[model samples]
Target: MSDTHAIAFVRNEMLPQAEPPVTQRGLVKWLRENMFSTIPNTIMTLLSLYVIYVLLASVVPWLFNGVWSGDSIRDCRAALDGATGGCFAVIRERWPQLLFGSYPSNLLIRPTMAFFLLLLAAAPVLFSELPRRLLWFTALYPFLAYWLIWGGSIWVPLFTIATILLSWLVFRALESRSFFGAIVAALIVFVVVSIVLGGPVVALLDSIATIRLQPVESRSIGGFLLNFILGTTCLSLSLPLGIALALGRKSDLPFIKGLCVIIIEFVRGVPLITLLFVASVMLGFFLPGGVDFDLIIRVIIMITLFASAYIAEAIRGGLAALPKGQYEAADALGLDYWQAMRLIILPQALKISIPSIVNIALGLFKDTTLVSIISMADILGMTRQRIMNTSEWFGVYWELLGFAALLFFIVCYSISQYSQYLERKLATDHR
Candidate 1:
């Protein structure tokens, strides 16, 4: 019955002959280990508890108050007891304007269809059981999406059909190992058929119509959707231009190098809005005297140039950060400069600078808001106008501003988080 017996019992059973305690499996143990493991943690926990209680004391009641039960705005103002709740009926009524702007009574279908198309296109990535055709679908999905959004001609369908047939023929030819020859043959056939279909370039040129750009007509196309267009178009246009500029900056030719530097520096020095103004006014002067210019198109051109200058600098940093040994190694492998860049340098450099690119894109997203000052009716413009009519004007500002801030934060933060994850994964692979 003494220590000797206890020792013998423990050795014999590999246990204490009974469970220690049930409290070890419950909230007590979790609290002890997780929330109060150290003195600093326990202090912080108590502080957080106090802050939460104060916040809940103020927030929870107002959130469930009669104010939130509004069916119409009149019901909302009636129930307004200086509470902290939202009148969601306002959101319900104006939701269409918020989402689609003044897109057109019938054309609302177009944006909705675009949304569904995007989700449909992305569905395969989320559900792996989807058909392998999804991979090929992405290659032409953008064109398909644009076609659905903007209803084009019969020629568009014909082009799509021809593209599909050409793809199949190329795959068939390459599956038999005539890849290089097939590619060359395909190019020749494509060029010859294009010429036959449209006649000579000169003939087509003669058939083209010249138009004049009117400023007021161009400015009419500004809205929430335009901001998104600007962002995406800027990214698409700038990325290619950036890559070219990066190459040119690193070029051996004095002329090319100097030109790239001047272009990059000049764009970087100017504010984006100034560039937009210049585009709205001065871009037309550079073109032929009678040629028409669209304000949105000119803004896009300026944005493309502006974003490209920054992008070029970012890519140049990536290029410079690469080890000189990479260039030498590419040369040693008998790769031409373009091959080395395309196959080796650029992929790694871009991967390394994905975080930087994402940051630049986030900046561009913010810069897009400036388009409102230039007369675009983006989300901010909608918010400013919406807040004025609200009865709860004092609190409405916070709610509307918070919504806008949240959208920006979520998009930018997600990009940053994803880039970090990619960076970590790449680091793991390198190791």
Candidate 2:
């Protein structure tokens, strides 16, 4: 018993790495686990492969035989000798029109430059790793973009910028006294400044208007440029407005909640096409006879309103999904309503709502093609009217339409990918 009592405990060193079993590694393992795991899965995989083969058999030859250079559809047809091949010549010849619509060729550089600058302006906002100072340029971008695309006297944006700065300064100076007072003071300062400067600014602008780029009319805006303008402007405008609407709908005050409810319901109830129709036709009756609203501006207003309504509902769902404890915690911390909402509620709510918001944005971007119904020449409109309708390119549908689809897909896909990145960046659960 004494000898047996001194039993030794066994110890083992860390094991060396070993190759995984052949059936549990690499492409073979993946295929077995995911594609051929069962009888039904194998059948589906084989069927899918056959479908892909059929699609490639048809599309590959059509793509490879595509006529990239030809004067007209007739030239393409003659080259192909009755074989099924895409007449992509229409896209090659009419690319400029498809991009800028009727925008003056000599002035194309303005929009082109603005487009690149948009990427710059968006960089910091999209990627937090970028220096925060870049947001200054982001703030200036709308005005810069307006000047670049619409081509107006520089003084107009300058005056607008000055007014904003003045209002902000006023608000900051008075904020310590009272928030509502500061807001009122800011508004008063803005209105008074506008009244005092508006006349002189207009006169000065008139004197130097000749120095600016030749003003492009809204009617001249078409092609994908029009879609970009509408999508970007409406998307930007809708977000803040949607946030305000969402908050208003959730407010304790009955009147605010009721008003937001009515607006959201009314806008959501109507078809977007109906709203476009109203913007194109019926909206004029409501405006003063002397007031001339630009068609693009009118469309923007309608689209923004429509998108904001849907976005409000999405945000409301986010707010509803929030745990009651979050609200109680904010309250327990002695945070004010706006403070709680801004710092705690909104960050979490918006994070949850990102996917929905991105979906709305994608829908809004694609819906911009519907501007064609109002006789605006967005990408689809340009393809249908300016390209395909031409005698030389008639019946070259697949090529032009395919190009439009590809363009939309690229933009939408980029937005989708960015949204995913944003979700990961904002993730708090650390998954």
Judging by TM-score against the true structure, name the best candidate: 2
For candidate 1, report its TM-score: 0.69
Task: Give the C-alpha miss distance for residue 196 in model 2, angstroms.
Answer: 8.1
Model 2 scores worst on lDDT over the 10 consecutive residues at 422-431
TM-score of each: 0.69, 0.90
66-156, model 2: which lDDT tens digit per residue?
8888999899999999897898888888888999999998999999999999999999988999999999999999989888988967777
lDDT of 1: 0.68
- Best prediction by lDDT: 2
Candidate 1 lDDT, 1-431, residue by residue in tens:
67676564335546457754766768888998999989999999999999999999876764565343444555676677565566655555555555545555465676577667766775674356689788677555666655554453324434545755775576567645664456566666665555455334324443463222111222333345556667766877898899889998999989989999999999999999899888867777888867766666777888999989988888888888888999999999998776799999998888766777778888987788787676666667666654435554424554455556776687678657766776776782361
Model 2 earns a TM-score of 0.90
- Which residue pairs show backbone clashes in model 2? none
Give the C-alpha miss distance for residue 257 in model 1, angstroms.
Answer: 1.2
